[model samples]
Target chain A: MNGTEARTIAAPDLLEMCAAHMRAGGRMQMAYVWFPQAGATPEIRYLASQGANQPFALWCCRPQPGEALPSLAKISPLLGWYEREITELGGVHFDGHPEPFPLVLHEGARSTLPPLDPRYPADQPVEFEAAPWRIPELGGKDVQLLPFGPVRADVLESAQFLFFYIGEGIIHYYPRLFFKHRGMERRFQGLCPKLGTVLAERVSGVGSVAHALAYCQALEAAASCQIPERARWLRVLLAELERLYNHLHYLGYLCHTTTLKVGEAEGRLLEERAKQLNAKLTGSRLLRGIIEPGGLRRDLDSAGLSDALEALRREFADYTARLERTDSHLDRLISTGVLTRKVAVDQGATGPIERASGLDRDLRRDHPYAAYAELPMTVALREAGDACARMQVRIAEIETSFALMQRVLLLLPAGPVRTDCHPIAASEGLGWSESPRGSLYYAVHLDQNGKLARVKIKSPSFSNWRAFPFTVHDSNMMDYAINEASFGLTTAGCDR
Target chain B: MPLWTFFGLTRGTATTAWPASGADNGQTGVLGMPRHYPDRCQDDCDACAAACLPGAIRVHTEASAGARLDVDYGRCVACQLCTEVCPAGAFAPSTDWAFGVRARTDLVWAAATQTAPARALSGMIRSTFGRSLHVRHVDSGSCNGCESELQALNNPFYNLHRLGIFFTPSPRFADLLLVTGPVTYAMRAALVETYQAMPEPRWVMASGTCAVSGGVAEGGYACAAGLEGILPVDVYLPGCPPNPAALIEALLLLLGRAPQRIEGGRLAD
Candidate 1:
């Protein structure tokens, strides 16, 4: 979207105008498609936004039933996943999709009804289709295939990785995940308004605050409800805390993967402290239950967080200094599993991954939500596009988040924590927010009863997962673990 | 390496003393299973159940029997919604950490009078695996909430190995099957196959509420709620995703090392 406001476009010019807009330097922010209960035709709206002066062109396309929808994946490979997602969920087929595969509803079981379809048989069994999406492989005679997991020794999320290798180095790897699909989006439709906030927090457990904020943002937008100023500041406070803890844990895990014991230990300790701090601030370690629609669930003392965060920031810099000084850590990360800027931009990578590749896109700055505009922040940037660069970006971001949090705490406005949020029946709205990893979004359509008719979530993981195959290509098989860890892709989020 | 080594030495150990002493864990606040008080429930009130996302809390009201509220902890995600919505304060926050039991019935804190108190494991079964326990974890369909705490078990603080609990890489070597997540249809075969791969005398511990009663994804068309019919679970440790401390308590209870502090939803005095 070019400007700050949203501009509506007719159904016919959805794809062509979007292509032209992008040609005119517009960015394809997200494409949200949904099934309207009363009608057979699905509503497809593509939000193309970029730059300060440009308005976000909301291209609402109504693809006639059985006709193939125009594919944006052909023009921008970044939208392949989104286009494929629309196909699987909205039951709209997009012509010219590079690889149109089922991202969530996999093939293997008995053929079942389309999960989110209005005509879906609720009582019927979810059987697999006769010919479902299959994992395809690129071949070479010298290449040997090795499978990694849907299950592993560690408490890793269930995801299978098939590494096509020639000798010790991988030529390419196909990751087959979503063995953890819990029909979350389907359940969201059936959830009560009050319960939506609770489950939204659990969308990708670690990003609870971000997801909750996104869900609430969508609800508030639909209802046109304004939360208290204090509530907005609290949201920022909790979000930054969530970011701090996740980055610590992610950094620590990356170190562990690379055999940097000291870095790993420091990361764990810092993450633990962050969790404890969160518990003290919000009554839960991961900051759950503190956020919901309208405002917070209840209020607690945030006074201690600033001091703890300051201490953490100081300690973090010292630990990172020691970490960077180590040759073993640096050697393993430097150019290991490099992702090019081209691949990142093409695949629409966000957060540290994009920043590491020199894209410098942080949704918090680009599209400010919550109290981000009030508490101004800087976007952390790096250009190496390596695992090390990703780590550097994360470390830098942690410091920035800490500083931002201190400012938010000092300048917090006092008011009510929560208020009544009533959504209008037969209304639809979009909510987007910057999570620890990247931009997280949710598109919700309410029924006549003011209940959720459908909710299509586009988590950061969904966009970032496309970069994985590119990242691991031709890299040493041993570096696979490091590459995976560096991306911080959540299998649960992707599967959802 | 020397500087880091020095830093590590100065920082010292961060391990917690749980089974040995007091293990401060992720147990405080609105995180664990709610302690339901049926007696305190408002007459014909369905607030908590109505507020429940997965229908974990059920209120059945008949003219003759009046109203009865039953909480299936396995289905509850510990969102503390029940605590917030219950006007009667029927659902209160609790500190009952040692929640593991051999029977699934033990996980149910009901509105009706208890018929069967959960019995300890059979002497023959306990004796077969008396010395130590090796767990093989299966991500049946977890959101990684349970997996995070499970990973914490290996971190510097918990050090689950100290308690003679080790996570094995293979089901063949595993003495106990520790499963997380609601049993999704995609993983149904994998779950059964993993159990099949395990040797005889292998016990099963349904770790989270999802494994025991399917948490929030209970009865979806694509997934099975809980592991009730799928497998015979020995230890039903119910929590949305039980904290590491709770897991420690659960394991200790399995070994008859820690006292079972919870019974019928409340802390047994």
Candidate 2:
């Protein structure tokens, strides 16, 4: 899995090569379909990365029209979602795929050709007529079905949960998310690299900096444009700020789910303070409108950045220390919605979820991007594989993020924050970032006019959401909401 | 529990006294929507229009006169790209975060014609739900930026409940339907159903630039251009994702508890 360049293998050897990579401890990072040229036959590509500090192994195969390709889901169950996604969007058939229903396209949704297929007429509109999804039947007198939402309570995103539970215990759990899909990846098409940052930042509001950084890096990689040193350090600063706010928000939301109202209030207040810091440092609270392809959109005035981080750090330590002392919060998190290490790896979990499950991997450390290689970071690991472990992972990561931000600010260089990124036509590149939720990757393909031809987003939430359902089955309904909160998933990330 | 209570008390009044005169709205030095000066704009220059991706700025050619740039704040994401690209110093970045208005037409601006003043809500509607308002938020196709600001409204800083506005779980109990995103087709049914479920005198507020005029993902294969022709909207607040204080101002303006500061798509100084 250490091959740096993408190799075009025949369709027959795709499964064998992937299996070998899997046997060598390589995990499938992402797979997608793209048209190599205008009206060209679609090619399905697979990307896999070996353990720490190794280059990704990329393999692609173009199947003749109507040719059924071998399913890699058998070798790695994590590929099930990607395979099904390719089947629906790329209009490819996977031979011997188990349980091949529509992954993204809902029932009664109509589109000419698959939406991701380049041949699909962009001008023609796709209609999503509301129709009932096929829910797997469960037999038993006590087993009843409950469809929770496409619209839920509170300020949560749109996602529906189909629960088949008997009494308090659950028989099965199925989540039908992606109600918030805005065709974000497609929106990148024909956009200049400058405007692309705006759309990438909006991919997931909380992961704004991470997505934008990854997108810009991909664009930079394509053109081999070397951004300024100050821009790299600033990217790290912005990234850490994003992680700080997201983790704090996650902790606060988790507190609400556990009925820790005071803890929730304290956490949110701290989150608000952190956001205010972001606003004071950068004009935008979410740190948007500052990242473009070559570098930052503007130079930041980080005069009081270290002071703000120190103050936030002190308050956060006190808050988390109090939470640890409270037994009620711990009781709800312990042993609730346990996702075993084996299941986590088998289902290809990433970020804190994987680290909490004892799969020690951080893209910042393993495959360093931005200024991460220069900074000292401790990848937090836990063996519990439960909600408590997840919370602990986030708490530890927040601490590391604070330290990293301080280091980045101290070593900040003086130079221009941006450079001219002249796009190289017909070039493709891969870029990644270790976001608060997990590792996020953006693959960009540039057109003749230096605009985006095709852009594929491998968001962390997409991977985590695929692995989330494993913990829900056979678990009681009581801990469902808390489990969900601990995962800290966003429907926009998945749906996009 | 006692420790938490004492700890909370010691933090000492984190709430801001906004909606009152000279209060800190918590958005000091933050960039808001782009402010346009028709006089400063060059007649042939369309740099801002070309830079705006959401099609918020468009140059319209009229047979009777010169080309006029139609500026729609409803579609503006406030990315400030307009200001960055404008050569004639026409589009200036301003801190006018409070851009909420009662009518959709109030969001569109043109240099040729003067716009009418924004109208306040009807007396009956305002008086009916003046003291308190229950809101049901729907995410038709948002990227969750709007939801983040919505969540921030409950923080101790903003404390939206103090203003008699609450986010309810049920549309049946909702007086106002606060909608976000560009109204994607897949969510069209659920959004409409929620609107139908609400009782009479129910109003819809399109928060964020996406809900106002589809933001950057406008006219895509999957979504409609905001809530324009889908449902009748009462309030239109535009931002890439409006900050928390802006949400409070919009909600308050909707309830007739606060005055509409935007007239003819221009912020009142």
Give residue A51's error in model 1 in angstroms: 3.0
Give me the overall lDDT of model 1. Answer: 0.77
Per-residue lDDT of model 2, residues B19-86, tens digit only: 67678888876788888887787877788888888888988766446336888888888888889888
- Evaluated with lDDT, which candidate comes out highest? 2
For model 2, the interface Cα RMSD in angstroms equals 1.1
Over A1-496, each residue of candidate 2 has an lDDT whose tens digit, in order, gives 1225578889889889988998887888988888777677788988888778877878888999889899989988988988998887778899999778876878878887878766676645687676777878788898889999989998879989999999999889999977777788878877887788888999998899999999989889999989999999999999999999999999999999999888999999999999888888878888888898899888999997799799999999999999888898999999998999999988888899999999999989988888889899899999999999999999999999999999998999999999999889888888899999898989898888888888899999999999999999999999999999999998989898
Q: Give the TM-score of candidate 1.
A: 0.95
Candidate 2 lDDT score relative to the true structure = 0.87
Kept native contacts, as fractions per model, are: 0.53, 0.72
Total backbone clashes of candidate 1, pairs 3 or more residues apart or in separate chains: 16
Q: Residue A124 of model 2: what lDDT?
A: 55
| C-alpha DockQ for predicted model 2 | 0.77
